[model samples]
Target: MRPSLSAFKIRANMKPILITGYVNPDLDGTAGMIGYAEFLSKTGKNTVAGVIGEPHEEAKYILDRFNIPYPLLLANANDYDEIVLVDASDLNGLEGKIDPNKIIEIIDHRQAHETDKFPNAKAQIEMVGAAATLIAEKFIKNNLEISKNAAILIYGAIISNTLNFKGSVTTDRDKAAAEWLNKTARLPENFWQELFSAKSDLTGEKLAERIEGDFAWFVLGDKNVGIAQIEIIGADKLISERGEEIIKILDKIKDEMQLDYIFQNTIELLDCKNYLVANDEKTKKLLEKILDIHFVGISAVRPNLIMRKQIIPLLKVELEKN
Candidate 1:
C-alpha cells in the first residue's frame, strides 16, 4: 500500500533549522552558532545561522579583520520550526525572544546553567573554556574541513574566552581545539594581543557601553545578582581614572534592576589579574568572603584571572548558604 498524502506534506513543509546564540551574544556564542551551522550543513543537514542581537565588538573585529561573513541578524526565531542554541542554555539569555519549546539542541559551557528549563532540547553542557571548542570538536571528529572563516572565528573565540589559555577554566580540550583550528585559521602570532586590544578601547562612552553590553544577571537562591566583566589591557588605569563612573553605572543598574548584589570583574590582560569593583558594603563583603581578597576603597585585586563563568558557581553556593 502507498503512503498517505500526510507523509508527502510533512516532507514538503519541513523548514531549515535555525541556529543561534544568546541575546547580545559574545564571541563564543557567535562563533559557535556560525561554526556549528556550517558543520551541520556540511554533514547533509539543513541549517541557517542567525543572531538575535548585535554581535559584540570583539566578534565584529575578527569578522571584519578577516573579512568573514556575518550571520543573519534575526529579530526572533518565529519563522523556524526547530531551533538550536550554541553557547546559550538559559532562558534569561533568550530575552523572551525564542520559545524554549522549539529548541531541539543546546551547546553551552557554563557550569551554572538553566538547561532544565529547555525541556525539549538535547543539551551538551560541558565545562570547557569556550563553547566554540565543542563546535570545533564536531568538525574534527567527523573529518570535515572547516572553512577559513569558521576556523578564525572559533580559534579567536577559544582564545578570547580562555584569556589566551591563561584563564583558570582553560582545559586540554580547549588547547587541542585551538591548535587544530589554527592550521586553517593561519592567524598571526600576535592575534591574541590584537584581539584583546580591540576590546580594550573603552574611550568616552565606550566604557559604559562595554560594561552594560557584557553585563549578566542571575537569580541565585533568593538574591538577584549582577555581574559585569571586562577583559582589557589597562584595568588599573581605567579603574583609577573612571572608578567613580564605574560605580555610578553599577549603582544606576542596581537600582533599576533591583538587584541584591552587583560587581564588576575587570580582567587585566597584561597583568593576568582581576580588579573587582563593587560600591556597596554588602557586595564588598560577599566578594571578600568568596574571593579571599579585601576591598581597598571600591575595588579588590585578584592575582589570577577568573572569568564570570567560574565565579557564578561560587556565588550560587555562597548565596544559597545564607
Candidate 2:
C-alpha cells in the first residue's frame, strides 16, 4: 500500500529546492527530474521539478500519452536558492543557463561528465543505463510511495535510455528498476515499441529538427566534439535516402558551433545496429580509431548498437592522449 500525499508535508522554514536537467533534455533527464522531485517531496522536502529548455520529442510523447503534467518550464535557475540536477552533470549541456555554484546536489549516470564543475554540489555520478534507474531505486529502497505519473515517466525513460535493455550501457539495476516501476505504471509489454515509434518520425523537416534537438557537444582535451544521436526504426532507409541531408546538417552545425569535430550516430531500433555518418576526414579518422569501423563514403555500419553515452568515454580516452 502507498502512503497518502498529505502524510508528508513540507517542513517549515525550508526553502524550495528546484530539480532540473540539461537544456533540451531527453526522456532520461526529463524523467529523472520529475521522479527525484517527487522522491524529495515525499520525504518531507520542498522540491519543485523544472525544465530549462524544450524537452525532446520522446519525453513529450510519454507526458502527452500518459496525461502526465509537464514540469515547470524555467528559463534559468535564477529564482531557486538551491538546485538539484538529475541526469545532467555537464556544463556544456546546461548551455550557460544554470549557475554551477548554486547547485546543491547532482544525480547522473554518465561515463564522461563534468561533475567537477559544480564546486559546491555533492554528486552521485554512476554509470547506470539511465539516471531514471537511480531515481526509481530511491523510491523502492526507501519504501516510499510514488505517483503513477512519475513511475510512468521514469519507466519510459529507462526503456528509452537503455534502448529497451539492448544498449551496451544497460545494467542489472536498470532492469530491476524497470520491473519495479512497471508494477506501478502498469504499462503494456509492447509499450517500448510504442515509445520508440513515437520518436521515430523523422520525416521532412523533422529530420533536421530531431538531429539538432538531440545533438550534444563536449570539450575533450583541446578540441570540441559534437555528436548527434538519432534513434529511428528505419535507419538504413533514412541514411540511404537522406545521407547528403544529414551531412549538410552536420556541416552547418559544426561551422555554427565552431566545433573541432562532429558526426551523427543513427541507431536502428528494429535492426539493433548503428549507422554512423561523418563528413570530414578528421571526424572519420577519430571514429575509425575509436569504433574500429572503416567508412565507405560518408557513412559506416557498426554491427552492434553503441550509444553516445558509451562512445563519449572512448573518445575522451583517445582524444586526451593526443
Candidate 3:
C-alpha cells in the first residue's frame, strides 16, 4: 500500500508518535493499534495510529459498518519522530519502514524475540490470546473512556483472534475483555456469526487478495519460508471447491518471491481445525517432517491446528532442526 504523503506532514514541536501494528494487519492488529493510540491520546500523548498495509477485507467491512476511520497508511515507519508498536514486537513483523531504534514502546500479546535490540524501549509483551485484550484491560484499569467506535473495533478483534474463545490459544483475559466491551458496545448476538460468514465469503480476486495480503515470511537456517493463513468457516468446502485455484496463486507467489518454501493453511474457525497445503514436494516433505501429519492429495488435515500463532513457531523449530 502506498503511504499518503499528506498524512506525514510534520509541524514544529509536534513530534508525532506513530502507533503501528504488524505488517498486513489483521483485525486484532488494526484494532489494537487504534485502541492503544486512543489510550495514549487520552494521556496527552501525540500519537496517531499508522497502518503498514490496507486492512483485511473483514476488517474493512467492520470499520466501514461502524464508521471507524482507518489508520494513517504508512509506507515506512521511519517517517515519524517516534514509534510505538501494538500487537507486534519483532522487527520482522513490521513493514521495514523504520530503524529499530525509533521504537520507544511495544504492547503485544505474542512470544517475544530479539527484544534485546530495543534496549531502551518499554516492552510489555504478554502471551494473551489477543493484543486487544491487553489494550482493553488498559482502558478499564486506567479508567479511560472508550469511544463507541473503539469499543466495537476492540471487541471484534477479541472475538476474531480468539475465534469467539473457542480457539486453543484463547485465554481468560481475552474472554474477560470481550465481556466488558460487550457491555459497552452492546453488539448483537448475531454479530460474531455474521463476521465469520463475511470472512468466509472470499472468492476469486478477493480470495487471492486474502492469501497474498496475509502472507508472512520467516528466515530459518538461511532459508526463507512463507506462510499464509486463512481464517474461515467450512474450510473443507472451500478447499474442495477452490483448492487448485488457491494453490496455483500460491505457487506463482512462491516462484515470483523466490521463497525456499511456501505453504497455505485454511483455518476452519467454526470447527477449530486447520487444512494445510504445500506448494511442492520439497516443502511437503519438510511439512510432513515438521508436523508429522499425513497428507491427502496436496492437502493435509490438521483438525487440531487452529492458530498460525501456534503453527508458525512450531514450523520454525522444525525448520531449524535441519
Top candidate, metric lDDT: 1
lDDT of each: 0.94, 0.92, 0.83
- Sort the predicted structures by TM-score, highest score first: 1, 2, 3
Q: Which candidate, 1 or 2, would have the higher TM-score against the true structure?
A: 1
Top-TM-score candidate index:
1
lDDT of 2 by residue, 23-112 (tens): 888899999999999999999889999999888888999999988999999898888778999999989888889999989999998877
Which of 1 and 2 is the better model by lDDT? 1
Tens-digit lDDT track for model 1 on 1-322? 8988998888856778999989989999999999999999998889999999899999999899989899999888889888999999999889999999999999999888888898899999999999999999999999999999999999999999999999988999999999999999999878999899889999999999999999999999899999999999999999999999999999999999999999999999997999999999999999999999999999999999988988899999999997
Each prediction's TM-score against the native? 0.97, 0.95, 0.91
Better of 2 and 3 by TM-score: 2
List runs of model 2 lying over 4 Å from the truth.
1-14
Return the candidate ranking by lDDT, descending: 1, 2, 3
**Residue 244: error of model 1 in Å?**
0.5
List all candidate RMSDs to the true structure.
2.0, 5.4, 5.3
- The ten-residue window of minimal lDDT in model 2 covers 4-13
